[model samples]
Target chain A: MTPITADATSLFDKLWQARLIKDLGDDRGLIHIDRHLLHDLSSPQAFAGLRQAGRPVRTPALQVAVPDHIVDTMPGRGDATVRGGADMIVALRRNAVENGLRLFDIGDPRQGIVHVVAAEQGIVLPGMTVVCGDSHTCTLGALGCWAFGIGTSEVEHVLATQTLVIRKPSSMRIRVEGRRGAGVTAKDLALGIIRAIGINAAKGGVLEYAGPAVTALSMEERFTLCNMGIEASARSAIIAPDETTFAYVRDHCGSPEWLPVATEAWTMLRSGPQASFDREFHFNCTDLAPQISWGTNPGQTIGIGDAIPPLPEPSAPRERASAERALAYMGLAPGQRLEGLPIAKVFIGSCTNSRISDLAAAARIVRGRHVAPGVRALVVPGSSRVKAEAEHLGLDRIFIDAGFEWRESGCSMCVGMNADRVAAGERCVSTSNRNFEGRQGPGARTHLASPATAAASAIAGHIADCRQVAGR
Target chain B: MKAFRKVTGTGVPLGRSDIDTDAIIPQQWLITTSREGLGKGLFSNWRYRDDAFTPDHGFVLNEPRFARAKILVAGPNYGCGSSREHAVWAHLDFGIEAIIAESFGPIFRDNALRNGLPAITLDGAAVSQVLAQLAALPANRMTVDLERAEVTGPDGTAYRFTMDEERRRALLDGIDDISATLAHAPDIDAFHSADRIRNPYYWVQPPRD
Candidate 1:
């Protein structure tokens, strides 16, 4: 492989400039999309729009379809398992066949959440431009790719032409220094960052995570970090590709044949010493505790041992109003400790924290104890391959023995699109991304936490810290 | 996409922040492949009272005076959360031609632009003043002029804004994104050839017949 040239620009700029097909001025550019990911919920309308416009997919080979969001994740589940989802599932399958595109259908070994499948199959690589119809597509940015979510109209536009007219977002680099303490994980760090900076801090900007703490995280942990970039309302989130990234991609299924060449190219995909950003932020996770969301939005969070802060005076009207509303919706008062709040259910899966390490973290907590009486617990892997690997490691047995339901892969109970859902009026501790009002279900109260915290909460029937359970 | 030059309509003031798309149109309403009839589902959770389907008169949109409101004025971060375009479709179907907010979610703003609805952003003070003025005079309307890049409130207060020139032209010409993208075919071809050499593995080879 020839030596790749290094540029004195940020990693984002390098990838963005490479994909620019035409600059339309005023920051808007038409960039060629190297990969387009589609799912059952968003792609049906897009495909229908393409058909209505008498257009065909420009590059069918670059597109991959999966039925994750609306598919049932129950064991032995078939296409008809989800109410009102059968049509969507069937439509996705039909569209894939009609367009001659590759699809990881239900029961396929490669089928899983679209983001997980893309990473596991090595389709999303360093320095590539990837777009998807889901907000969590930012997860691919962890692999050093320029990735972001698009609406159905943009999805249709990409289907017709493998390019999108996008405005260049200003860049922000968030540096996290120092080593993380025990019981701290990527989910906790992400929540802590969102709490420190309001949800809109990174709006209209791409966040490049750097520093010792970020580099110390594993590839899956980095995915967990980038997965919630959308929660911060960021255009995307990325990390420079390093040896950890190269090794993960090399070991994943369907890796490219040209490994050495890819590695050499990726080695150059980093920001130079003089690279500048529109804004910069520094966060220290040295003493960070396992974080938890106390209110409806992901930004309304606190460390596990800290009490919820009181709603401040109305001088900052927006903050006061948001805090009051979140408190009302969550049925909590200010200054209350979140630790003893009884939880009716616990979910240990989602695109945010459903990787193998996430399950292992939860498994370690549930190994000897059973879920508290009247509390329901579930463990859903992010992908079918993750499920197989977990079962091979006997993680499923541990979960089941601890009174938790072991389910197949898919976005189960995350968005509540399928039969798996938190019943109305029930409070749940979930490891998913969003904690919006009625996000899990109508009138379902959710407290977002890490996988270990979720498992510990299930055993204690409340929002308990993982350290306490481990101490027991 | 329909061409948009100007729109004049009564503004419905929804003084709320972080109004996510899930609340705009619930996940249950996303069952249809068609974008039609989503207006009925817009804010369905807030519009209706219970399973028996009692109308909630307290909801702002349910008020008789605001029944025909074609403009929506909201607080910051309106249309945050999910990237579902159905939120825009539902608002458009409900006769909303324009939305004025302090800010908007990037994806939602892009979706609105492509769907021919203008998500105009104004400063917080300007939006607050507009909302207060509209609240005092419910019959007063606002005018959004895409050509001039300004919004005129009923009291004749004007808020200036800016948009991408290409998107502005595409919206004015009523041209879909596909047509706009096709105009750059030559440039796209050039980039594709160079990109193929630089990142060969990024391309997925077609399956053999």
Candidate 2:
């Protein structure tokens, strides 16, 4: 148990203190949200509540707005280019400007998915509280911030007061030790964690990710880890910011004359070597392989070479009957091998893995290979900026040359908010998080994997190991 | 806000499942976080494309019979996608009060319940039967009783279903989750006051196994 703050603390204390979590009493902990990011999805209601209350925003500067979904992420464009999607994004800009909030509208060079851009810009500092309407807000926790998703009304409350009345969550520390294999990426690690802990099992719990393997990850990788915490039903996922974090922030946000002062403050952000949690889970990444979800939930996953888990024995008939129903609904056979499952589509984009590094990995796999005949492979960047960077590096050409559709960013196909979608009954190897039934599109079957695996599956037209491919 | 003891509407015929937020209200309309005047953008793309409803013949909202639909009868696995609360708001603005589907996405269901939208799921075949019954009649009338959790169709036939009791109570009381949680504020405050003990050295060292 961590000590509660000696002084009366603000609602956002843990973030301001650079502490993982100080006890807030009972099972709750006082954590902070460093940055409050907004998107079109949850902002409207929040703003509505503020209007109803006749309250003015306490600190608009701390709140930022970006539009990544419900807009077209087409190549060389922003939300404005996507027909009417621009109108909403533009409205956010107007609201931001009028309310004195920071706005990153479509076409802004810095714009992308809220989470991706937050890390890349160094806006997500360690020991900060970051809240957003999007569940993937946990992505910022990788930078050592306590970021998570909130409801629309909660957003309104935070905007009006620059504070949140939150219940302290129980803490759960998950430590992954050892080094990873060449093909095993942060995505695989996340998938592995989800598989170990069933979805919704981590509900109301704060998950702190640590250990040597976590320390070795880049800021991008940490983002991947924290992003999936929501899928596990965890309140938040955090990793203590280290030199790599400091370096990334300095490189992107810039280290100025006041850097030394900020650094001194940042040094105190880590867990004081003695921090404890309510629960702990450990993993040895040395033998971890690229992972994929074969069933309806992220927890129902198997390693690259492993087979799907056979139906578990429920103590009674009714519970066993439900398990059978789940298997049937998921269209999976107990003990069936997960590899070589035929796939019709491959999607690589989402806040989960749409960064430049994610694209680079896919580009490597598709460099000299063509997508399997009859397969539809689409690569949607997380934001316009990511698309631009990928094009700058000619990643679009590589994907297109390999017969994959290099389309716009936005949350395409990841959640079926845009035009991109999987046909009914189609099986897709996707880089997006979540393998929930019909999540991508109605009646579509989703197999969650890393970008490399998705790209490799596109080439092989089946679930294949990315490392087995030539050159990559 | 006037209390709606009874909700009545014409059911729209839509067979598509997992109708995500993007399809409900495309990203193009999400620019302003303002909740005002969202009715026009609701189903904007599907309503008008190329100055004509693209796939005009098959688009559910374009059907002449259900032109003023206020209740949507959809297939299984409805509302599967990003947990944007906007989708529910768009539906409500478009005059939707009750959604009858085979099943619903968890987050979307929660959002709808919070906003007084009733997301009721039934057996897929049962929903198809209700849709067929509605389709068989021209300009069918549908009535949903919030207090009873029942839907009456054109022929005065009633379809009964279940809703999460907790959500039903909140909706009946017109309280969102935030308000519901706030109701326990005094209790939560007491918990904090009574449980302020802390560990001395957990921040710097791992806890003992």
Q: Please report how far candidate 2 places residue A354 from its true position, in Å.
A: 1.3
Q: Which sections of candidate 2 miss by over 4 Å?
A: A1-33, A76-87, A314-326, B1-83, B86-209
List, residue by residue over A119-195, the lDDT tens digit for candidate 1: 88777888888999988899889999998999999999998889998888889889999888889999999999888
Pick by TM-score: which candidate is best?
1
Q: Candidate 2's residue-wise lDDT over A79-168, tens digit each?
A: 544345555566667668878877777767767788887777656666667888776787888877778776676676567644454445
Judging by lDDT against the true structure, name the best candidate: 1
Off by over 4 Å in 1: A1-8, A253-257, B204-209
Error of 1 at A180 (Å): 1.0
Where does the lowest 10-residue lDDT sum fall in candidate 2 chain A?
A7-16
DockQ, computed on Cα atoms, for candidate 1:
0.59
lDDT score, candidate 1, position B43: 85
